[model samples]
Target chain A: METMQPALKNGRNVWDSVNMPKEEFEARIERVRTAMAGRGLDLLLVYTTGLTDCGDTAYLTNFVIRLTRGTLVAIPRKGEVVTFFEGSSRGLPSLKQTLTVGDLVAAGDLPKESAAYLKETKVNVGTVGLAGLKRMPFQQYRTLTSALEGCTFKDADDMLADFRICKSVRESDQVRRAARIVGKLTMFLKETTFEGASQRAIEAALYRQARFEGAEDFRMLLAKPGREGCSVGPADYVPMADGEKVIFYLGVEFERYWAEAIRTFTFKAGSFVEETSPGIISGFQQLCAAMKPGVAISAFCKKASAVMAGKGHQALAPFGLGGGIGLGLSEKPLLTEETPGELKEGMTFALRMTAESGDNYAMVGNTVLVGKDGGIILNVEPARPAE
Target chain B: MSDPNLKLEKTLELINKKGLDGLIIYSGGTCSILGPSYLTYFCEARPLGPRNCAVVTKDGRVSLLVEPVWDAPRMAAKAWITDVRGTSRFTDDLLEIVKGYGVNGTMGLVGGREMSEEVYAAISGKVKLEPTDAIVETLAREKSARELEIIYRASRIADLGFEAFVGCARPGMREYDLTAEMEYVMRAEGADDIFILISSGSHNYEMHEPTDRRLKKGDIIIGEITPVCEGQFVQLCRTMTLGEPAPVVYEKYRMLLHAFAESLAQIRPGVEASAMSKAMNQVISDAGYAKYCYPPYMRARGHGFGIGSIAPGGVIDDNTKAAFERLQAVVVHPNQYIPETGYLACGETVLVGINGIQRLAATETKLYVKEV
Candidate 1:
């Protein structure tokens, strides 16, 4: 999650009607409208900024901001939805081709543009539910609130997160497709030769491989096998030595859906053999099996912690026990000691479990879909390396 | 560009001058070529979390606070500050750290604009956070000797990126594939971050995110290749034709090349930054496309790239009031929508000084032709 932000998000750009149809968006909007009706809200503004924070708006409109810019979706109770994004007015022509919504405006200033649009549409005066509006830079937030003085705004981030925590059939399919890409790339990594190659060279090769595989955005962080820090970083320029083990924290977004996969491999003679602790592997399998619909998230996390503590393995901290993974890499209902939530079916997340072998620390993880029966790991064999 | 000791001295000076208890250069993780994280400049390390700040107290002690609670070791390893603490509760820890310092006076916030409403409101409740972005901008506008060296290295990576872009441009390859190839080559050369926008067609409106559109015969591939090294970014813009370029294509691109040169010639310290844009526009207008100098046709002629400030800002048009300064890292491009050959890209990054300009990249600013 701490990977460097790529300047140009040159990924697979598409608005697949079959995979993520307009009807899907219509359904999402309707769901939000239903929530709005209960809250007595007249309009909902779901705003986001930058590549990482683009999820809230992207959920409503299948448009992601490639660079650092503001994007928002405005859903009024009684009218067609309109979305605004940060870009030059000239780009509106080409940008229009990418969005599911017909009424889209490309503007330099989002708050100003939203205000002007609302003033023109006469929807400025009302109680509006604001979601992810806190992600904006303070200046822009002030400008937005000042411009829409007639509207009373309530924070709807929790409501929005509750709705977005669960994956729909199409959303799950999109995640499946993204996870498949991760699986294929893991096979690619396992089979490839890293002999005499710099860590960055491997990173470059992986970037190329993922892009060619139709991956839109790719990020990988390199960590030494024994490294204790959870915030694994970008690759250094040094070549990966043979017999040296490395752990990769990799994530890719396919058509707006994200899937992250973590695996550790021991390098020898240009090839990789996965290194997995039998105890940790068995523990993770049991933990995933325990991830049922009615399982309390904190309890599950506490149990995982207890198991790890018993095995003399410590939590990896921030990147340790994983959380929800969907439009954003980390969503709500995170698996933590004190986070109040339950593992509901349809909630998707990156499930990671760490193991210790002597002084070395190793981790294995994959994108998981919480199911009625249990946690369904959305990965191929050897991705988890337990096979 | 100042050394850590010098930065501390300056920070102390600013705190004393402003009558403040401390200074906090914050990072809201809104880092890009458009804007570099202010905290990255102060800390000399990129904090991989959403909320990180460098806290400089009046006691001359500087401590870093990084989010995610696990990035502390990484920050401690690289940053000049010895006290690097990572916290999951960023807002709470930041407030606690400020209270621990125990100064009830005001605090200067360098990147106050970057903070979200949640963070701003949270900090405002306990302490008065005032925006001090411009003060740091004025302090760091000029590059240090080491930063300049890194900029040159980054520019070389940009050149390599264009070389890769040229090597990968071919018929039937997707635009994103070309982007991947270019990015890989740059990454292989140690470019920290890459920002590339590309579009392929016979005639183009503007450069955008690389789509699935494959290159075809006679397609004009335009791109903005930016390779960042340690927060210093250098951009290269080039337009290549898949096949033999038309006569009009050659003619129009030549004008852009001339405009680029004209713009470069005007880039010395103390001159109004608008002079460069005015010069570039004059060449295109003189070539009988004066009507295409404004928007709906063209955006900014250029923008400055720096550690903490992308000054002269995004659009360096004739209306821009800022003057070009010494050691300023700026990317000057005449990327425009020309009716004759669609949009042709031509630009270079340069270091501004008394010597006018030192070109960062070795890539020639002209139309590239990929042989059929």
Candidate 2:
């Protein structure tokens, strides 16, 4: 008899850098079930749709729906979890290759299918937990409620949000990998970008390097100096003039975990060069310094405001500090004045802050892991680029 | 030169015909494929968030409501509707707009599925709600010259993507590497959005988002490269052989080519869309693969490609009943899984013309054999 090699439990295996081992997922399920049991929940239904809402479902199943559609995963207190997605049943062969969830069902109408599955499982009457319900289409929510008439549904987005806010060792490893790819891609952007190069081309180049490094999803938003309100996806193929400020807000998901970075570049003469803002850098540093374990996010916000004020800028208006970055581009525990959570140990955040002086606008961000000792900056580049 | 005014006039005409007070075209980002976001059609705007609703009154007054509340500046810049308002409170803001338009009488709803039950309940009692999906579909069935130009440009971008697919399909690279390269070429060429799926193996099942599986010698590569410009989508289903494939592979590919050719021939203005599927399926069935033409073996012969108005619906199986209209853009793929050659891809996007089908892509539909 041949002896089998033991499953490795270290930093990113070549194959499983983004995707953790089954044991990690099993442990997560145990944590979730414990929370659900305490809350007296019979089943937990995690509904996610479109690109932005894909994190909650990916956190549990490692199954992210790439298409612009709705997908749901139902986890009962006892039985196996099942996934329902908007695709043909024939596509199950492809789904199996991507996701580990076995009982996959093709759903034309998500709520109807979820209701039918709930009825079949004899979970007709119990307190149901609904995570990511905010993003669910109102039509589906009504249908789901009407179908499970005897059951009670409660908003449990915080349940998963709280669970996913803190990163495990393996999850942190995945975010670091994603951050490394973002760093390399941003560096490439700084080198190859030139005048007459369209936003589409610059974004395409970023995608090329990131995908080559095995990124699952790449999202970018472009804006000019005065036009700070960036839209989603690539803009028209318009060239930037020399001495103009061009901002690229980029986020990439490796495996299912996510990390994001923001950088501003100027078309100086003939080439693109990294631009810096002192006010933004000062505020960003203050936020990073305050990201200690057991500290409230509100305290960090106050510190960030003081740094901005001391730097001759106004108080931080909670406009730019980023949120949690894992499984989703922006998760719960957002670093804002109104955010309710504290910085816990094992938490990871994408610390981004922006400041304005005169007509110029500057933004900088980096992914950091909150450890027992202090915050560990996962990104290779600093929060703000050096002059 | 896209004409948002002309599209809006056509929508108003449909509302007048339907005997409604006005129309509410709802968009839930990319999720509403069934009743797709017609905002891009009427206002030349694509939504960034989950929900964006446009209310057009009978008096030519149009008000738009978008989510995230922050994208108002961007949305207002793109849309001609001056009464555009961004909202974080979707239901409340939209209700105010609907009431402000004095839409108390019978009203037409273009995207019924996009509206939640709560919104429906809040407004249905105040007005007679009529689903105007067919009206919107009819108006969008015929594309304008500008729309056709955009579709043509999108097709050109897809050709570049296919070229990159061929260039990047090396032996040792992962499937995602090829996908990335292809996407890079298309994006650089100015494709606003992209939907790429790839499968590489000797016996492939279906094209999906590229996995980390590395390509090897004699691997068969299948790619469904879709590039979107403005709102028009152009797709190309292509299969390439990594090395000199087996004789059986060539024979099966030829069968797919025949099916593709036959299907493209049936795509005239007057022909029903199902006829194209029937013609394509017939070619495969006649090639001693009768059992492989149905589900689990194959899916759609083609689907309509657009953001606002994907007419003839998204799927064009043998049971589809809609007829092809002139200027309508659709992809006619006869991708099949056969016992002899496994899954092979062969398809191209075409414009339904008065005379016959006009091929949109410059790339010929045939098996590409890459030498080892």
Candidate 3:
């Protein structure tokens, strides 16, 4: 058995050092500033709490913290960006290490401290936009509202969400990297012959491998062959059997970007016991081929459903089809009946199609980025069919 | 037949001994299960939905109050208790049910710290809510045969994870990739919930979250993997050296292994949980690594693992006073910090038997080495 190499040291990893070029970051900021001006907003207070908030914060400052508490990115209309993080004086060193010199601020005063800093920096808060205020706790909201009493706080969460919906080349690269890792692991699991292996053992192995491959955070949803439950965590004692379907929702974080894919595996060669119909393979292919830039998401969903219906497989609920992928495992450009927009170039999304043939359900999903010409599949492996 | 009621009787005896009027148990979603696990130990079935509360009185009249009106019927059918009521709004419904039961007198609230401020205010205003760790601790400290069966099964699953790591964990792989592979296998096998914390480095500062760092030729990857079975938690902490470990790393491993052994040796019925922690600290301190045993360096040596109670005893330092009881299951990791090696993971789950402790998981004590 060959020993593995160490991947982390002194609280910093390779992902921490991966930087989006300063020029590109400035360009994104300039785009956001233009949007702000069009919306008649003087400033944007882009707030994020816990691990989920890293996207907005990283958009302004290329910093990401792994703590459970929240961080706020205060983007003024005309000045440098500042961030307020949770913790005491002891956290300053780590704060400095993770954030840039101009972006770090003590969290003790929080909204007050942050608001005062912005005022001192000449932020005209008369027409400020606030994103992620719902995530802000009551106490923090009170402090910020008290500090910027004269400022009008309008919701700009939609603006931030819209801005992030389009993926940059750098962001696409990270997503592709994450997708490649998932592809390799999925292939490995298919080859492992999971009969008699308990759920806990399988989960432990996947977690170890994910860490070894540079995944910062991992979330998985696993369903056994016979048990078609919708739980997110790992189950214990349940063993793999000969003719069951396993739905695996795998997500990995690379450089603060999240990429997710869902795949269903079976252990035997046969259609589902009840339906005896062909699986969702053709449907998935049809959806993938139909998905193109400038196409309406609802139209895409309708086409996918039509393909499944033509194949005599039960079409999945429109909501179950996947959506955009980026900072969060699930993002915008959602595939729903009332989806309001069209797929744009540079937008990345998970093309998930689920079909039920008799008693068994088959799902195939992959992370793909919208290219000028067509859809660029991030993880380029064909779906593995059960033997 | 070994009486199934023995555990419940023992729990009630402990409740009387502690002089508590009643225990208020609440489960907040599946992730937070302080309420349901404690109630389920006496009764069966978990409360449905995100929020559910159960009050087990001294007279054995158990009342289960849950949010989401649809889940009440499911809760009633699953639990043996008769008084199960479902409420649409949690705070208002919770107050009315408690008031109806007249449990507003001196009552002990288990798992109330994580409750929202609105729930806390409602409960405190009506009843004198005293936070007690005893409610879940007494029932959860000792594992039942059924609980043990689930935990043992969970350990077997963890062992599969070990094998998977050995098979797939290689240099150049990203951390999340390995995690995804493991998760895929676990889910394929039928895992419900898994909590995994992994670090890869020769000098691991702490067993923090996973990162997207490609494994290097000589990185040592450590994982603290735990799978929550039913309501019980079974954990396995193991460290793997990717390539030939540095001599200094091996030395630190030996020291940690010895420290782990010393901690295990100290486990027995009636021993103060804190004493075992202190004894383990002494093993490291005597070796001139005292600073590593405390904060900014190392968090806790180990903690209790079970269905409803962690009985963490707060980082088992010298002044800690939590005691170990018979049948209690605990995980003691000699997770030490040294300037040479950041944090080396080594631990196991042990059941405090009548005589001594029995190891649950089937992992070897020595450092697991995988040559690159």
Candidate 4:
């Protein structure tokens, strides 16, 4: 594989490097400050663990901790932002390198350091907003809470989630690059016949091809049409049979941005087994088509169920309809029954549809962007066999 | 089915022979237990959340104790071991299971190092808590043919990652950026879990986390790349020198290679693990670089690699006393620092056979020179 060159700013792509420039970042912080003032939030503590929930932290500060430890980004209603990361004296250089000179605190003494810094800086702490603290350990939460004594802790995950739902120009470019790679690999897999090959061999071939396509990270789950359950990875060595339907959920990461696409294939060219059945496909399409800027998420979910039922397939319950995707594989603004509000433009979601036919099951999903006209498919490819 | 049963029976017999009433396999979510990944060897699935354990008795009955009521059914189905029970609190549930077994006379805790203070106190009150790394280590050391196949595949993936790193790591790029690219490549290669520790500098002071420090001309980028496949661990540590390396750096690299050679030379069926560490230490010590052998300087010379047998015999160093056994996989990284050339990584994972040790990975041990 050859090295991937940094992307250049151009109108050829949906996004460019300019989306994440220092000026845009400063503007985003300003927007956060305005939102905080509106919500009466004096301070906002955004926590991220590993690569999973680091988008918020990375948005504010370009640093992403590689370890499985928590990193926090503290943004007061008015002041300089500060970051806390776990490490020893060895972390000093890294802190200096990744963070701005004025925006760093040793993670070992984070609570004390944050308190001292906040007090010295004289930032008001009345109503503190927190995002991504659901998985945060209690000790860390307690420390932050205790440090800001009179502040009322409120879940501002929605505030952060709202900001994350919309993809900036740079993020869209990265996702588009990742999507192109995934699309190329999916097409390659379709051409590569699987007869006499084990699942492991086929998976390995796909992985190798993805790397060749310049995907930074690739993950795939292969399920035979009539298989019992979703057995991801290359562990199962089931040999490919002529009539078996193969489904692949493929994801690729480019420059730390992730995009995913799901496709199904059959061995025979004309034999279109309901590899991810069309009934499920129609349901997903209806949901995707209905996703507009002003439509409530709950209403969209209801429409999804009605579409599934109308197609004579068991309506997939709320859990599988997918949600936002960015730095992490899955993000908020989830399409669940309890989801708070409306769909917005620039937001991305994976519209998933799964159905069971007797013993056989099939699923088809695609990442989509909410456009003014309708949801646009990020990974565009023919669903049927090539003539 | 019968093979696993027979193996369990033989293990139980060995337990009887060793005069231990029961073996307590303790695993918790921490750096010591290395998180839930190690539990996959016995349970066939990674444990979720805090402390959970599977205790097998001399009489052949097994019980799995876990926290949180919701995880019980999932653990039971995934582990393929019925008699799965759980507790809201780990300490009380652990005590109940031990008392129920009636073999609480002398218990051997597999991962005693990571047991919580509350759980340890509860168990020690009723049963004698003996710290024996043998229970899990012995089970993990001998990989079944099926397990070996997974490790072999994982090693191949690691090689692919190294190739990816070689292509992507360049001057004017930040360490974290390279790390992100490498991880993204590995994920694309279908790697489920990756533990990559890397460093880059003109002189790599120590091998630690990735930083945003931009690589300069003639910098050395060292990486200890490990990928987890089917819950098995396979690793390769290599150093890449950007542009032409200085004479001193090359000499230090040669010394590290020599130290690794001395360690590899000591591997055999009957050789003690400590002997191999001693041999390697002597090579560095004789070269007047002995002070970097232990703690305040270096953590470990080498360590055993597998699903759950990370520290059974302890990390290979001059103080190690574990004996080499057939099919025991170990990685020897004489990854040390020299005042002249920062940190040099020279290591390979090898499997001990009857006659000698065989390298698991096919990557070359020599320093890779990446042209800027």
Name the best candidate (by lDDT).
1
Evaluate candidate 2 and give its CAPRI docking class based on DockQ. acceptable
Query: Lowest summed-lDDT stretch of 10 residues in model 3 chain A?
Result: A1-10
Give the winner by DockQ: 1
Q: Model 4: per-residue lDDT, tens digit, B59-114?
A: 88888887544456556766756778756777777777778878747877776644
lDDT of 3 by residue, A179-261 (tens): 88777667666655445666556655565555556666655655433234332333345565666666777777666676776
DockQ values per model: 0.60, 0.40, 0.12, 0.12
Measured by TM-score, how close is model 2 to the native structure? 0.92
Worst 10 residues of 2 chain B by lDDT: B28-37
- Mind giving the per-residue lDDT tens digits that candidate 2 earns over B1-372? 367677778878888887889888877666332234576676777767666788888878899888667667767887888887888788778778878777888778777765655566766766677888776677677677777778889999999999999987899988877888888898788877677777889898777777768899999999888887776778899999999999999888988898988888888877889999999999999998878888777777788876568877788989999888887778888899888777888888888889888888898788899997
Once fitted onto the true fold, the runs of candidate 2 whose alpha carbons sit more than 4 angstroms away are A1-19, A225-234, A277-283, A314-319, A382-387, B31-35, B116-129
Give TM-score values for chain A, per-prediction.
0.94, 0.87, 0.85, 0.76
Clashing pairs in 2: none
- Best by TM-score, which number? 1
In model 4, which residue pairs have backbone atoms overlapping below 3 Å?
A: A216-B184, A216-B185, A217-B184, A217-B188, A218-B187, A218-B188
lDDT of 1 by residue, A1-387 (tens): 666666657776777888888888888888889999999899988888777767878888787777777788889987878888887777776676668864887778888988899889987778998888888788888899899997889888777788789999789888888888888878888888887888888888888888887888888887664444444677777788888877888898999999999998888898877878788788788778888998888898988888878888866645678899999887887788798878888999898888864667778889999888998889764444556
Clashes per candidate (backbone, < 3 Å): 3, 0, 69, 6
Worst 10 residues of 4 chain A by lDDT: A1-10
DockQ category of candidate 3? incorrect
DockQ of candidate 1? 0.60
Query: What lDDT is obtained when candidate 2 is compared to the true structure?
Result: 0.75
For each candidate, give its TM-score against the true structure. 0.95, 0.92, 0.65, 0.68
